[model samples]
Target chain A: MYLAKIFVTHKKSILDPQGEAIKNALHRLDYEAVENVSQGKYFETTLNCDSEDKAKQITDSICDSLLANPNMETYRFEIEKVGD
Target chain B: MKFAVISFPGSNCDYDMYYAIKDILKEPVEMVSCDTESLDGFDAVLIPGGFSYGDYLRSGAIAKFAKVMPALIKFANLGKPVLGVCNGFQILTEVGLLPGSLQNNRDMQFISEYEPLIVQNNKTIFTNEYEKAESIMIPIAHGEGNYYCNETELESLKQNHQIIFTYENNPNGSVSNIAGITNKNGNVMGMMPHPERAVEKILGSEDGVRLFTSILKSFKGGILVE
Candidate 1:
């Protein structure tokens, strides 16, 4: 079995209001070094597959069909062998 | 004209849309389940507001994969009149029936209030009852109503007059203050404002009645006799 960790974020061109809010909150705490913040979603799924390549293909399909909206979100995933 | 109010999971405003047509407009309407495979007899399709699938992932993201969506796509492709208000608009964009995406409101606050909208184009079948450039009042209620699209798409929308309505005072930081827009073919429309909620004066404003009347006229061949 393989576990895929997926991260989805708003495209750079798109505004992230929640991220901005977090940045402002950080600024109040005197985190002056922080120049920017972006918000996104993360998902972890365990897939039963034959190989890493198969896991990757399934993960890609998941993101394209359901996890990430192609219109405004970009996503990336990493696979790890979790169980035998 | 017969209308179908698509009832998706978590669709809270489905009744409001049905009421707008049946109680106020005195028209034939029915609630169509999201799992239906076909939209066979409906003349118009209404995707009402409300967070579908609990807004999981993104607003309208999960709902796009609903069983009825393929039927909705086919209905839209037929150039039949389709209206999606608020969350419905989000679904339309999600399902690729319309262009652009609705993001979180600029202020990241859920705005629920009567807002002013200007009829940017009254030539389409949807807004034919309104005068060109006429400003009307409609209620908007959503947290993710900020409309976004690329500059090229915006240019094309402007050139094609697909922008049906624009906010008089931009509330959601939308590009070009776009409140509503039609597809390139002008048959499919998606807007963030609740026209059904404003269909009756007792509810608030009657500015939305014309929007429905316009649809009726479209089916009636724009005779404007009534």
Candidate 2:
């Protein structure tokens, strides 16, 4: 078995307004030392596959097709063996 | 012209679009479901505002996979008129029918009010009734109405005059003050403003009524004989 974790976020050039707002709020709360903040979505799933290669393929395909909008977002995922 | 208003799972403005077409314009219109596989017999397609799919993943990230999307793509390929408003606009971008994506407002607020919009291109079927550079008030209500496109796409959009509308005061901080845009072919349009919600003076402004008239007039060969 494999456990896959995916993270999706706006592209570097894209303006993340929600993240900017959060940064502002942090400053208001006296967290002025923080220079930047990026926000994104995270997903975890247990793949019923035994091979790491198969798990990676499934996770990548899902991220490309649905988990992120390529026009403004990018995603990265990691897979690890869980149980036999 | 007969129009089809697609009603996704969380669509709340479907009826508003229907009324704008059927009652106000006196044109034939029907409410289509997201599960519908065919858009046959419809001259135009309307995707109305609202949080489709409860905006679960993103505003429109999950809606491009709806059963009706394939048919919608075929309809657009035929050069038929397709208008997406608000969340509908978001869906079109997700489907790659239109360029750019709608993001959270710069101020991170859900803005809901009458906003001034300038008709940038009056030659297209969607804005033919308005004069070039004419400004009109329309209602815009959304949390993610800020539009963003890459520099290259923005340059091409400007060069081709594909930009249909721009805001007067730049309410949502959209790039280039863009409020609405069309595909290079000019058949498909997506706008963040709710023109359907401003069709009558009773509602607030009737400026948006001309937009519907424009589509109908184009179907009648750009002029009404009667």
Candidate 3:
């Protein structure tokens, strides 16, 4: 089995409105010199596959095809032997 | 005029678009499921608002790969009238049909309310019903509607009059307060507001009715009304 974690975010050049609002709120709270904030999403999944390589392939496909926007997000995966 | 409203899974505004086109404007409109492969025989295609694909991964990201999107691209390439609203707007940007990206709301919450929209380009087929600089009140409902584009692209859009709508009061932290934009060919338009939601008087305003009228008029000029 493999564990996959996906992180999705606006590209660096894209303005993050949610981040800007948080920065403003921090300023209102008297925090000094906080420059910027960016928000993103984290998704975790467990894949069922026969071999480690198969698990990697399936998980990667899911992340690239559905779980992450290639232009705006990136993802990573890990595998662990089950019933060891 | 014949129109098609693309309905992706989790889309909530398809009915509103249908009513606006069929009842309010009296145009023949069909609801096209997202899994469909073709937009053949359609003069115009509309991507309505709502949480397409549950706004999964990123807003409109998953929906960009829907089977119907290729048809949308084809329609756009042909210079047929295509509109994306709110979530649909996000999809258009994701698919590169239009520029810019929609980020999360500054408030980090879903916002649904009426906001003032200033018409920026009256020459486009979409906004020709309104005068340049005219302000109209339209409903907006979205969690990711902030528009962001690079400075050079922004400058080019301004120079080419691709900007079609601006926020009157800057509700969201969109770049330059832009609320809507058209493609270089002026065929594809994407807006963060829900114009179809405002097309009926019972819904509090009929300002959106003019948009449909404008497109119909454009199609009827020197051509048979399909």
Candidate 4:
């Protein structure tokens, strides 16, 4: 088995309104040193693939087709062998 | 002409779209579930607003995977009109039927109110009933209506006259104050405003009636009557 950890976030060119709101709230709490916050999504999935290379390819396709919107967000994933 | 309002799970405005077409526009309309495999026999498709898939991953993110989407894409490719409003608009972008994605409103609030919209390009089938540069009132209710696209796409939209509407006052900080846009072919339109909500004077404004009328006129193969 292989476990894939994925992260999706809005591209830097797009405005992160939710993250901006959270940053403002943090500043109100006197966290002035905090300059920015960008919100994103995280997901973990396990696949019954034979090899790490196959799992990586499947995970990448999933990210491209379903997990991420290429127009507004970017995604990255890491695959690790979990079991024999 | 027949119109089909696609009903995705959690779609709240599908009936409204149906009512606007059947009752107000005096046209035939049907409600189709998102799981249906084919959109055959429909003259046009209307994707209504709502929290499809509970808006789980993102607005219209999961809903784009619906079984009916392939049919919708085929219908669009045939140059049949496809109108997507609010969450429908988001789905169009997610499905690649339309360009650009809707981001959360800059204010981060769920806004529901009447806003003025300028008819940016009245040449398309969806907006042909309205005059160019005409100002009309439409109700906009969404938290993720801020439209975004790359600079090159923005330039092309302008060059192609695909921008159909612009907010009079820029409510959500959308790029270029874009309230609505159409695809390059002009048969597909994705707009954040709810024209279905403003179809009657009793509902507050009749400005939205012209939009639906435009579609009907196109199907009838006639010129604009009013």
Candidate 2: list runs displaced more than 4 Å. B222-226
- Runs in model 4 deviating more than 4 A are B222-226
Residue lDDT tens for model 2, A3-24: 9999999898888998899999
Candidate 1: DockQ? 0.77
Report the C-alpha lDDT of model 1 over B1-226, residue by residue, as the tens digit. 8999999889999999999999988999999999999999999999999999999989999999999988999999888999999999999999999999999999989999899999999988889999999999999999999999989899999999999999999999999999999999888999999999898778889999999989998888943212
Docking class of 3: acceptable
Clashing pairs in 3: none
- Model 4: how far is B87 from its true place, Å? 0.7
In order, the first chain's TM-score in every candidate is 0.94, 0.95, 0.70, 0.96
How many residue pairs of model 3 clash at the backbone?
0
CA lDDT of every candidate: 0.93, 0.93, 0.83, 0.93
lDDT of 2 by residue, B11-92 (tens): 9999999999988999999999999999999999999999999998989888999999999999999889999999999999
Candidate 2 global CA lDDT score: 0.93
CA shift at B32, candidate 2, in angstroms? 1.0
lDDT of 1 by residue, A1-84 (tens): 999999999999888888998899999999999999999999999999889999999999999988988878999999999877
When sorted by TM-score, best at the front, the candidate numbers are 4, 2, 1, 3
Candidate 3 residues A1-84, lDDT tens each? 556565666567655666777888999998878988776777777767678888778877887677766544556656665643
Model 1 alpha-carbon drift over 4 Å, by segment: B222-226
Ranked by lDDT, the better of candidates 1 and 3 is 1
What is the iRMS for every candidate structure?
0.9, 0.8, 3.0, 0.7
Q: Report how far residue B13 has shifted in candidate 1, in Å.
A: 0.9
Chain B of candidate 1 versus the native chain B: what TM-score? 0.97
> What shift in Å separates residue B157 of candidate 3 from its native position after superposition?
1.3
